[model samples]
Target: MSQGNYRVAIDIGTTKVCTIIVRKRADHRVEVCGISIVPCDGMSKGMVAESASVTVAIKESVEAAAADAGVEVNAVYTGLTGSHIESKNRWANVPRSEGMRPVTDLDLSAAKKAAGAIDLPDDRRLLHVIPRSYALDGLHGVRNPLGMHTGELHIESHVITGSISKITKLHNAVFDAGVRVSSMVVEPLASADAVLTADEREEGAVLVDVGGGTSDIAVYHDGSVVHTAVIPVGGFQFSNDLSIAFAIDFESAERLKIKHGTAAPELAGMKEEITLHPTTMSQPLTISKREIGQVLKERTSELFRMIQLKLEEPHLADIPTDRIVFTGGGAKLDGFLNIAKYIFQRKVRLASPRGLDGMPEGTNDPAYSAAVGIALWGMRNLPAENHVDERKISHTSENSGTATLANKQTAGALSMIRGWLPKRDKETAGT
Candidate 1:
């Protein structure tokens, strides 16, 4: 594959760090060229707790993927998720100085900027400002406002923000690992891109990405993101619950959870018993299958209820959909969907990564969805390699000229945001 066409994405999760390299073919489809997943232990609940350990893990994951693909990757698109993530809908109006003139791209950009002019605290950083809908004069719900005649153009936008300190730590970790961060995309958005269908997004759907340390949520309606959040509960909590209940080491508990865990205890065999010789235990231990299921059920139920509570927030109560899609490693637990359907009383399904070609067979699971989608996000948001002037970067000093190129790259990224869903042509709005 040509170097100019290679795109890399890294997903730094609590339990693992995943890196994927893809090459865009002549047909404009991305195909996996190399992929690597390495166990990580430097993060908790989506925030880096030990920068050194995270850097090491990122380095190992990236180098392995680069070696597998026989290419050098200098930069990557990484996923971000944590409880610090926040979002809200903001509206703005732009009155055309030239009254009744046809709406143009410049007018759209101005409206987006006006909507995104929020006063954020010093600790917070803006992530994305996505336009949900538009209005011309007093008329609302205009999908494409361009070319319309209006005295005032109004836009309702979804603005997403995150903690600057947390983002800086992650950025430093990736930099120490020897790759520049091309851009940072929220995890829920990336996972939704990998699994959600166009119809699901347009018709309204809730995407729950249950990772190792967090379950990220993204709600979509009319083909735009309306809400996003990160819950600090996931596979790690499930295994920890088992560990504490059984008085076993975390590794043993994790093994047991993966081998016998289920959200619905009633689905497990009533009399089946499992035996374990944990390193923490001197003698063999035997436990009932249903007992393990019962423990997990409590945590699983709590997580679902939390998700429900989040949806019950006053702004979300009237959302027009009852469909929820679950993705990521935790969602693969036996009986996960069965329990979710029972709790939410809505349509539910487990989804895996899509839209990429030549994915390795074992990588098609929900666990790899964020990583795959990060690659797709890079394809959509990052500037084309051919468009960047390599000579300017090579000749630029570390502090001055390099800064100019970085600014240009950042502008390119923001401009490429068009829309979060696949294939929309509107410009993004955010810092």
Candidate 2:
């Protein structure tokens, strides 16, 4: 594709809708040319609850982003997440060609077909079938097997499937807003693309994204996503707790939480107190900081504990706590990393998305990590090669069999390597 062609990514998150525009440069680097975010009025946890409200919000965000980038967008790669979605790894075996020659595109295609053959509810559909790795004979971890001689080929993948109705609703909403849905990516996957490094993913790590209404987790090992799940809790729940406990309005409670909330009450001094304005009372009320901390700790700990339980699942046992990386709006909370460290009993660090140009200071906040990552993903995954060389269309059709897996693995591995490599060396390396 021409370097000037702009790609747009829309993150229809729970509490906010964000749109980002990026362009691929001659050097193959992606630059964030524009961004726009608006409060989500009719969506919750990445699902559209009110189509009209969501359509309006999406259109406004898109228009704002287009205006900033000085270009119009005809289609967008959207993000999707919710408690209803599920992801799992499955394996499939495909036989070699009749002559028992090297693995062919047909074999890869067969493997993908097998992986996508899982039984699901009538209202569900597969969103992504990401190959984790290929196995030739008994040798696993084979990244590319196109020309490799093997009698049997085995493919492992993370199959992401979601509610068909929800996905359809999202498509319709975007369509109503006068845009085409080029693709739909899982939210955690997009966030992981934006933040986590390759070494972290290979060495085993978990990415936790604490958005306004939900906490999404993706576990990685050996440079592939092993598990992904969502917890129905986030910063918004903390605010709700404060609002109810203090008998105050939501806005006031949010302010207090942002200003004074802590995940550990034992660390707060008993003498400390915070003022609260109750909804019914005429006078402001004073509440102990320790008490507020205790409440915050309870809810956050519950969320973390659920994450721990998910980690306990056999599929996620390889994830190491020492490699944990936290992102999202909630990661910005004061003392949150401390609390996460205490609960997980390991080193924890806040992760932010990088490698974009023209991003505003505040827009660099973790809250925009997913949106920015989506933009990067679009630039990298969209059919750029098709646009670049029309003559290569037939090659694209042949490679589509393994392109999804290869692209994701390449992206994941390159990101991990970039995080740990020396500045000069990483700059010279290709993603």
Candidate 3:
């Protein structure tokens, strides 16, 4: 394997911190060079509570990954999630500065900069401003307007923001861990990139990543991201539910869920049972698997229902996508997709990273999708960022540098995303 470019991605979830080292081969396929996954402490729902504990968790994961890859890393592309993260569509109309000149990437950059004028609360700051589409004059839905003469260029983009305190806590934790946050990627964005195919993006889709601590959503259409959000509820809730119902330790409960839980209880055998030791007793107790499945089904159903309400509140109920793609650790549970289909009432699919070379054993699962995708995101996006945060970074080009705050006003400019879908149904239709 030729060492072309190697990158590290760190995903800090409520239950664990994972660091992955991926190396791009000469043929452009990525390989898993190393991996480190450790239980996380001092975090809840993606927000860092205790900096010292988070720092330790990050340090251990990165060091373990480095040791395995036989390469020391000083910086990383870190994933962020939580209810604190928000996104919206925004646009900026830049009159051709040159007066009837061919639009270039610079013009596009200016439009993106213009769209950065978001009105965020004092507690929040911009994390990412991705150009969604370009429009020249009145002709719209242009992927790129470069090399074409136009009097004005309109830039529509998706801006992701996070709480100032939450952002700072994450930065401090990584810095204390002896690494720099090169760039920030929304967890759902990375997960979508890794799991979604080109058709999924161009044809419209919603990616639901049920991480350990949060469920991240990325709605894509027209080959770009239109909306992104984070829900604090996640797979942890399932484990918690089981723990309370069976009076077992959290660890034991989680194990039970992974091994036997299902989102569709009717599909499970009611007579099936498993015995486990309770936290307070040396004696083992037998529990019906049917009961466990019922608990899981209820929890997951409630989770999807909440998500549905949020979408409606934002008037995103009509996001143009026929399929709902589920990923993340929770998606690993049996019958999760069936539950999603039951709620969304549209086509549903499971997603994971595809087309990788030398993928490590047990690393190609949906759980690793974001880690793999964020590394790829770091590779493809390092150039568009002219100024990045002053952190040690990889895959940086001389043309790109700092990660600074983009204004909030540009957060919701011109926002229409298009893609393929099953013919709209009257019962549960897309608008």
Task: State each candidate's clash count.
Answer: 0, 3, 23
lDDT of each: 0.81, 0.74, 0.74
Candidate 2, lDDT over the whole model: 0.74
Candidate 3 lDDT by residue in tens digits, 1-431: 22336678898877677787766556566655567776675777767877788899899888877655556786788988889998888777775565778888777777877888777889999988999888887788888777988887888889989988888889899999998887888899889888898998988888888877678988888888888888877777888788788887776877788888888888888789898876766889798888999999988888988777656645355567777898887788898888888788989888777655545545567877777778778777774321122233332442121111011101110010011111111111101
**Comparison by TM-score, 2 against 3, better one:** 2
Report the error of model 1 at residue 339, Å: 0.7
Cα-based lDDT at residue 256, candidate 1: 89
RMSD, model 2, all Cα superposed? 10.8
Kindly provide the TM-score of model 1 when superposed on the true structure, using C-alpha atoms. 0.88
Of 1 and 2, which scores higher on lDDT? 1
lDDT of 1: 0.81
Which digits, one per residue and each the tens of the lDDT, describe model 2 over residues 1-431?
34334678888877777888776666566665556776665766557778998899799888876655545677788988878779889888765555456887888888888778888889989988878889988899897788898877889999999999989999999999988888888888889888988888888888999987678888888887889887766777777777677777666766778788888777778779887776667998898988888878887888888888978888665456466789998778777888898889877899888767656545667887888777776666556521111232222222231333333333432343233211111011111
Among the numbered candidates, top TM-score falls to: 1
Clashing pairs in 1: none
RMSD of each: 10.2, 10.8, 11.3
Best by lDDT: 1
Off by over 4 Å in 2: 1-4, 278-280, 319-321, 385-431
Q: Which ranking of candidates, highest lDDT first?
A: 1, 2, 3
